[model samples]
Structures are given as C-alpha cells and as structure tokens.
Target: MAGENVLVAVEGRRLQLSNLDKVLYPSDGFTKGEVIDYYSRVAPVLLPHLAGRPLTMRRYPDGVDGQSFYEKNAARHAPDWVRTVTVDTPGSSTGAETLDFAVVDDLPTLVWAAQMASLELHIPQWTVGPRGGRNNPDRLVFDLDPGPPATIVECCRVALLLREKLRADGLEPVAKTSGSKGMQLYCTVTTTAPKQAWGYAKELAEQLAAEHPGLIVARMAKNLRPRKVFIDWSQNHEYKTTVAPYSLRARERPTVSTPITWAEVESCREPGDLVFTADDVLDRVDEHGDLFKPLLRKKNPPKLTALKSR
Candidate 1:
C-alpha cells in the first residue's frame, strides 16, 4: 500500500483498508495501491466519525469520456449496510460517485452529513425531500431542487416563502442548500425517535400538500407523482439513508455538498449557483458553526406529536 500510486495526495497521512472503501472506491481510475495512498491522507480526517458505523462508498474514475457511479452492494445481493447509490443527473451520461457512512439510521446519517461537510469543505443537500426520520422526530423538509432550466434566484424565493410558512406554524426551520439545485428547509424539534417522526412527517406533509396544491405533493406513492416536488417521508425509517455531505457525488465533474446562509439564499436565483468549495467550506464552519450540534445538547426529552389531526 505504501508503494502504490497516489490518486489524491494531501501531504501527510496514513491509510488503513476498510471494507466500505474497498467496495465503494474500487480500483477504477486508480489501482488498489493508489487508493490506499489517497486513503492515507483522507482516513485520518474521516475515521473519527466513521468508527463503529457501517458505510456506503462510491468511486470515480478519470477519463475524457466521463465518470461512472457504482454502489458497493445491495440488500438483494449483499449486506444491509453496504450498498451502491447514485444521484439522478437528468440528461447527463456521466454521473459522480455519492458516498455515505453511517451506523444505519437518520440521526447518524444527519450527523455524519454535517460533520463530513464541515470536515471535507463540502456542502450538504437533501433530495427527494421528505419529512420522516427513525431516530429524529417527525418534521417537515422542503427540497429546493434545481429546475431543468431554473435559476438560483427562483429557488431562493421558494425557500423564503417556505420559511414564512414554517414560522407561521410556529416551527423553527433550518435552511441549507441541497449541494445541488435548490435548497432544503428542516424543521427542528425534539424526539428523533423513529415511528413518531414518521407519523409527524405524514400529518405535516398531508397538511402542506392540501394547502399548497401544485406547489407540493405527498410522494408516498411513487406512481402518482409527475411534475410536482415531493414531500417524502420515507427517509424517516431506521434503515433508510441519504447521501452525506462532502462526499463527492459521481458526476462528469465532482460536485460536493455545499452550505449556504438564508441571507445568501435570498440573493440567489438559480439552482446551479453557489460560491462554496471543499477548500473554502471550513470558513463557513467557523462562521455559521455546525447546525446539528444544538440538538445534541438538549435534555428536555421531546414531546413528539403531529400538529395535524390524526
């Protein structure tokens, strides 16, 4: 491993072989030896968070033609923890690798995403926006997806309007870019406990969908959805997961998860717009700090319940 070629050199570090890395990263553009080398530099920054949890890794190869994404495994052919996942990049042949590391559940998934984004200088974005979480309480998620030909400014307006709606409901929502097209508004609350969150998400989603017809739709049943943005509650399950922040999604060009401010969000007009990168995101960490930490400090045990009539 020490003598292998280097794929991504970051100066000083050590590498250890992990099953997740072997399957996700593979030996595509770089050989098994080369991957070990890059791992030497990256593992230290990544391991502390990865310890004790299972991970899902994705790999990218360099070529003029473009990149390809492959999941490590699937439940049908492999273990529950290791799986290959890809993002939907409309009309593009080459997609980027999307990796996630977690013990198995939403809270850890969220924690890993926030830490990875802050550590690797990447922005985190939620997709197929939903409101359910097994480890977290039921809440709302507004996915700010990029349109086929939409601008960041339009997305921002959508988010601010969402913010207003959430406030009207007396929910304190946290906003963040999905690292790709649009943004996500997560309503914070106690009780990350699974079923309760799912119930809450269901009621909230139904309420919002009914009031904001055309603007939102309940996405529980896939076959019915067409052009509307889905308020997905499926992500609330204990085993379900989303791509973590800072993980390079397999695309023609590697796009990382990015974080943005509500003020910055107000000034934008397109989904493909942003001013963050892996190297500059730490500055964001310093300025805004981690958004998930406050939840961990609470001891007031959550009183989880749906605002809507069950």
Candidate 2:
C-alpha cells in the first residue's frame, strides 16, 4: 500500500493523494490520511492565520521517527493551482537571490501539503500585501521554551506573567501550546516595526527574568536556561517563523499546537494537563470555537509605541 494513490475532489480541484495508509506517527499508528483529515477539519480556522503569509513546510515524508526537512521554496512539481510568492533572500545560502514560497490559502492547498507529509506549518508574523509586498508584522509572539527540569507547568507560570505584561501595554494576548515541550503567547499589533517589537519583547522578558529569577530566563545561552523558561523574544525578527496554531507538530504522536484558555493555563499543575492531540483539538474547536481569532482582527490593534514610556 506504500504506492497506493487516490484521486479526490477538494473544492472542485482534483488532487492525486497517495499513501493515505502510511503511518506518519509510528508510536500511535496515525496515518497520512488522518493528517489530511485533521487539516481539512481545522481549515476553517487555520486558513485565516495562514492567508497572505508565506509558509515554510516541515516535511516528514517517512514519518516522525524518520528524516525531516525544512522546505522554504515551493516544490517544482507543485500543482499549477498552488499559490506562490517569490521573495528576495540577499544572503543566498543556496546562491539563489530569491525563493518561491507556498501560500496555503485554501483547503485544497492544505490537503496537498498534507499529502506530502508537511506535518508542521510555520509562518512569520508579517503578511504579504495586496501588491505582493511584505508588510510590517501584525503580531508579536513570545515562544516560551522550557529548559531541563522545566515543563509546561513552568511555562504556564511564565505565560501568566506575560499575559499581564501584554495586557498592561493595551494588547490582548492569547496562549497556545507549542505541541512540544513549551507554549507561546501572541498579541496583535498595528504598523509596528519588527525592531520595535523585538526590543519590546526583549525588555519585558529581561524584566521578568530579573523579577522572577527562579521561573524565567531571558538569555538564549543554554547554560542559563536550566530550571527556567526561555522567553524567545527573537521570534519577532522579520525572517523568523513560528509554528502556526492548529498545525500538527512532528512529535511521536499527533500532538497539535493548540490554542488554549487562560483558565486552563491558570489551573494547570502538570505537564500532561496541557498536552492536546489532533482529536483533542477538534473537540476543543467544536466546544469553544477559535480562541485565537483575536489575532486575526485587522482593525484598531494596539500600537507598540504605547509601551515606549514604560
């Protein structure tokens, strides 16, 4: 069944999907079909966060236990219908000045990526403008990564503190699990430069580290991270990308980067309390709707300048 293929119609577009029975998560026996199904069910909410943004696919063709690669350029064999944006990359690691990135704006595109085993979808905080220009970041993200001896419970404490700091700056932040070992906090911004967001996040992270020495670590140095959560403020950089919420992570199981409520964060006492599988996420969406919708609002987002005086 490895080479088995099935042709299906998605939104009137025909896609030749192959290896639906291939296990992408060996630990749980989760298959490629399940991955596509998960993306299909979550597309209504996930697509908005991905629209107009160039995506970087983390492909695990063989499975989570096998080799994986980060794909920034769109595949040459990609369907003609797949939308792509070509952007400049001056550094030229591959000796190419620009790369064509895929934009997963619809259900068919999402399923197509899933068929290729693109389990994780990553995107920058910025979006592509109507004229195919890169816009200033519309959101700020704080990726709370736990060091050793630390876990999601510790990340929860740091998230609570970040929520308060962001709120005081007049921005409403949402929390989501990293679907790995930590979590992230996101807040909307309006016309804020990337440098400004980076500086603001760094300042707040350092301030919290100083105030809560035992619970947080602001520096990226691995030695300083033990027993503390590292506030990855650097993710605000223009070129950096965070895993899109609702996207599945390449873990042994089908764990998803899920949006969560503050109440759950407040009550979390163990690491397992925050872990959510693909099925778990679908149920949450059914019950609570999209808690991360606030980040998608385009109007009247708080400006980063409000925190300049602080």
Candidate 3:
C-alpha cells in the first residue's frame, strides 16, 4: 500500500484520510478533522509512550453517543508499513486465538487511526518486547471509579491518599483525570510481570481499603462499594487496558485524559476543575510539555515491601 486517496503528507508519509467534515460529537459539534488534528499535535509526546504498547481501539465510527465498538484487529486496509503485534487471547471451548493490535509509532499512523474515528485509545500496563518476545509491565495503574455522590473530587482525595502510600514505599506516583467522571493514578514500578503487578496492586488496594473503610473500597463488585470510590487495581492484570494518558475520551464532549500536577489535585475542589477539553490539552502540551513523560523514562523502579496486613 504505497498510497491511496491521500489527504496530505503526514511526516513524509502519505496517509489517506477520510470523513473530515463528519460531526462526531453532536453535542459539541466536534468534527472528525478536529480529532485527527488533536492527535497529530499530540503525536510527538504521545507516540513514545505508545511506541511498543499495542492499542485496543474504542472506535466511534459515527460519534461518541452513537453506536461504537472496541476493535482489537488492525483493519486489513491498514498500510503494510504500519506495524502490528500479535497477542494471544484467552481460549474458549474451541481454543486460543491470535489477535493483532496496532502499535501507533508515528504521526501518520496516529492520523490514520483518527481517520478511522478511534476516539478512545486503550493500552495495557505492559508493553510487548522486541521480536514478539515476552511482554513486561512498565506502568502500574489504579483506575478510580467513584460511586454516586462521590465525584471526581472524591477520587482526587482517594488518589492523594494512595499517592502518599506509594511514596512511603519509595514509589513516585502521579494522577490524571480519566477524561470521563473518574481519575487514574500511575506509578513506575519494578514489577515486570503482569501477575506480579496485579498481586501487588491487589495487596495495596486491599490494605488501603482496610485502613480507610469510609473513603476507599478495594472490592471489584459494584454492590460492595456503595458510597465509596472503587480503587480498580485490577487493571494491572494481563488482559485489561487503561486509557492512554493524553487520549481524548468518547464523552459528551472531547475531554482529554490530561496529566496533572499533585498540587493541582490537592487544590481541586470540584470535579470539573480538573476537566480538560481537546483544546485545553493542546495548550497544556505547548506550555508544560509532557507531564507523563518521566513515567516512560524512569531510571529507578519503585521500591515495594510487604504490607503489614491491615
């Protein structure tokens, strides 16, 4: 696939783009071109984090509210130059199946995905190694989902508490808005295996919940976590994926999963205080650069010790 119906040359690579005028977000009147433009502008910092990590696309062919689907297979229409990594999927009665996930490594591929109307980009904690070798967990994620009446503000409080605990354990953690209603906290940890990461996260969450029953709930069942923000440490597992930082969420509007400073988190009194749109994120990148970049290039891994068993 040399080139076909090229929209324009993106980073010296001719990319065929489509549906530039389609209004993806009817509420906000956001068009497909805007999404492509946002991805293009953020590509410099975003690409490094996603270089080896395969993406699970949350495709909104029509819009955010319209029917959408999560796609694992890179479309056959994708250019042969576009890279793909095959991953093993859990088996059923039949057997296991191999799935190909897109590895977004450049501006052209990012625009190509945006052209497909991929609104929400999902990535796993671990990244696939070179030559289809073993994958390793590079980042540990905690997805904070607040229950009714417990807004993003509450999630921030919980994140702050978790952050301190992680700091105490010699880990440097950071927080970001999930671009939806919640918040996500991440730390660069020494754990390379997904199972090890998952177990460590489980232990941390469970201990925290036990320490602060009124504030945090570590349980996964929705029923068990009434009036409490659930610390979804389960995202550390092998199969699950978290929203890639700096990605636009498929919300009512184009909200971005913007990286934030700890001071901002502490001062945020309202949930909307930390909410950022696509334009806001672009401005942030221009001013502050990649706040989440250090996580990818951390020199020292996090230090962890056995919990006291709360």
Candidate 4:
C-alpha cells in the first residue's frame, strides 16, 4: 500500500495519485488505477445524476476486502475549487447541525475523489437544490432485495410488478441492477414535500406485500426475510442515499450498478442476466446513452396521493 506519488493533470486540474497499482479487488486483481480510470471515463454520464447531490463516499483505502469507511463530511484537505454543500442534520435532541458534503460539480472533482480511492458513490434521492435550497426527494426508489436462496431473478420479477403499479399511477418507471445481489426501480417524482415520496412508497409497498403475502415483505424485520423479496421503501427519505447508477460496488469483484431497459427486465431469467462489471458497463454506455437519465431530468410529477383515492 505504501507507494510514491505520481502527479497528473486531469482536465487542467493537478492531482497527485499514490499507490495506483494497489490491488482493490484482489479476487480479480483489479487495481486502484482501474477504479480511477473507470470513474474518469464514466464521469460525463455519471456526473449528471451527481450534479448537485451530497455524496456519501465509500473509500476503500485498503481495497474492497480490506478496511473501508464511509466519508460524509468533505475532507478538510479538499481544495477550495472543490465544491461542497452544507446541509442541516438532526443532531442531539434539540436542534440541527450542518454537514459539509462534497458535491462533484465537475469531472475534475470526480477524478479527485478517485484519487482518494473512493470506489463507490452513493447519493440521496434528492439534490442540494439550486443555491443549496430546500432538500427534497425528486425521485423514489423501490429496492427489491431478495432473501437467501433467492436472487436477482426473483427481485426482477418483483421489480416488474412494482413498475406496473407505478405506471398505473401515471408515472413512468425505470429499472437498474444494484451492482450487487439486488435490484432497484426508480420513478421520477413531482412532489417537493419531504414526506410525500416516502408516504406513497410505503403505502404502495405495504399494499403489494399485503396482496401477495408469502412472496413479498415490506417491513424491515430480519425474521421476514425467508424466501421473500423485501421492497425497501425507506430509501425515499431525504436523509437516505441509494447507490448511484453506473457506480462501482465494493463486492468481491468490481461490478457496476448498470441501468437496464424494460425489455431487459422482462427477459431477466437468472442472476447473471443482471450483473455487469466495470468494463461491461463502460461498453454499454458507449453503445447506448444513459437510459436512467429521465429520473434526474425535468418531468411532470404525478400526484401519487391520488392513487390512494382509488
């Protein structure tokens, strides 16, 4: 892990990288250089979703298998040019405190984060808003996580069902692999109210779980995770974060959270169908532009509470 420094200019920005040859994914022998290269290459497409969001960086200083830590507060060492957003956090019992979170405003900052050996990027459902305005969730996520003995295929089936329900509510939905063993579905939200998204998602999840008892579980209880897939509605909260699409995972191997088409979701028959490595994801982006872009783009928000009126 002890290596010398190598200076490089990233888009005219100076960065000194160390231990680029350090193995992060020892199982596949993928080095830190490969991680940096992957983020740098994917920055153009990846940055849009990350534009104004506070990033909870997952740094793998000793690689994926080794010691890893989540960095919420921007490092004090960060250069002045690196943009950050200060948001209020619920502290103690009386009031709130501010946290300075890194906002990857440009490709230079993206590469610099890679220089820190941050293997994964996770962003909240909402952005920091213009001029760091009110934090609200612009989208909602339904994380279909399967229990043991079940896999991505099961989650895929459940995702399709969730998609249909969201579509019925007059909202278009998109599906993506979680880069690990699970899958996530996203829908563009119109409400700026902090609780609307979570309320809608929780209601929908409970309704579905009630409609299909054995196959689904909406509650976040450990005992409920037997041969069932959990619809994680809790991700819709403003304080929570979901894995950024196209971000790398800290799994045993370097897998990416790649977006998928609806047809791909329909044809997903097994776990392997949902997996994409860093190289595979890069190739996919080259062939097809970002399909998950709609979630972050301006769109009409559906009155999810109206669905309850039915």
Q: Which candidate is the best by TM-score?
A: 2
Model 4 segments beyond 4 Å from truth?
91-96
Instruction: State candidate 1's TM-score.
Output: 0.56
Output the better candidate (1/4) by TM-score.
Answer: 4
The C-alpha TM-scores of every prediction are 0.56, 0.97, 0.94, 0.95
- Residue-level lDDT of model 4, residues 1-310, one tens digit each, is 5497888987888888889889999999999889999998998789998888898899999998889887877857577788888877665132537777899979889988888888899998888776777566778899988998889888888887888888888888988999999989998877758888998999999999998888899999979988899999999877788999989999999999999998898898888988899999999999888989887667567655644776
C-alpha lDDT score of every prediction, in listed order? 0.43, 0.91, 0.84, 0.86
Q: On a 0 to 1 TM-score scale, where does candidate 3 land against the true structure?
A: 0.94
Which scores higher on lDDT, 1 or 2? 2
Q: How displaced is residue 144 in candidate 4, in Å?
A: 1.0
Clashing pairs in 2: none
Candidate 2 Cα deviation (angstroms), residue 87? 1.8
lDDT by residue (1-310, candidate 1, tens digit) is 3233323212322222222222222223323332333333333333333333344444333321335344332233322432223332233333323323233232223232222221122211222222211133333344554333444455566567667756665556666555454455666455534565566656666676788665556664554444455556555543444444333433333244544566677767444456343334555555666543322333553355566642
Candidate 1, residue 106: the lDDT equals 29
Q: Which candidate number has the best lDDT?
A: 2
Summarize candidate 3's per-residue lDDT along 80-123 as a digit string, tens digits: 77788888777623254877778888878888889889999999
